[model samples]
Target: MKPILLLFIFVSTLFATQYSVIISKKVDVGTLSAQQVRDIFLQKRHSLGNQKIIPLNLVGQEPSRIAFETDVLGMGRDRLNTYWIKQHFQGITPPITQPSHESIKAFVQNVEGAIGYIPSSMVDNSVKVLYEF
Candidate 1:
């Protein structure tokens, strides 16, 4: 590859935003493993025992969403689309989507068992961070 292309890659990676998985402060569940997060986001697992979990997604093309999907869920866009399509046939639906980090934080803060991810910088004490990446 060209030197300029390599430099661009390095710069882009250096500046990439970090993300965190957050849950409502009211949720009793503590830290979660990556597989647990993946299951929740993919709708393969619903609740942590009696407490139901509602996973939230960002609307449209958000960088955090892409990072969460790639790093946490370990799936590409096309694969995720196909997975959701197959899930639809099995009566499973995708996670609810919020327009922005603010909205996701608000929803998680207010809802009982809500869990969502946002840019690490956007997190405050209003919600509990389950994981960071």
Candidate 2:
């Protein structure tokens, strides 16, 4: 294999494995099914149990934001933009959006019924990882 190709593969693999989302430690919810988590993130439904659900997102230009939309939300950029635009025209805004992972973490920690995604390594005792994938 070409050295340059191998180097590209190595760097991509390394970063890909390094991101994840976390929640408060007190959050008793176990590993959530992917679909349920998706629902919450999309605001398709509320309440992940008795706990009302509030989803948060990273800033618009962030790579992690793209990953969450494509990898987790399974929506392409165009489609998501259209969805949000329609929601706006309908007088409904999407979930709270933060400018960075750090802001997302702080918001999730401070707000009840809040859930957000960040790098996997960022997981700490202050938050629980509802899912990783």
Model 2 pairs whose backbones collide: 19-120, 20-118, 20-119, 20-120, 23-127, 23-128
lDDT of 2 by residue, 38-96 (tens): 88777777886688777888766788888778888899989988988987877777888
**Candidate 1, residues 34-65: lDDT per residue as tens digits?**
99999999998999879998999998778888
Model 2 residue 81 lDDT? Answer: 87
Each model's backbone clash number: 0, 6
lDDT of 1 at 97: 95
Off by over 4 Å in 1: 1-14
Q: What does the lDDT read for residue 82 in candidate 1?
A: 100
Residue ranges of candidate 2 with Cα displaced over 4 Å: 1-11, 89-91
- For model 2, the local distance difference test gives 0.80
CA lDDT of every candidate: 0.91, 0.80
Best by lDDT: 1
Q: Return the TM-score for each candidate structure.
A: 0.88, 0.84
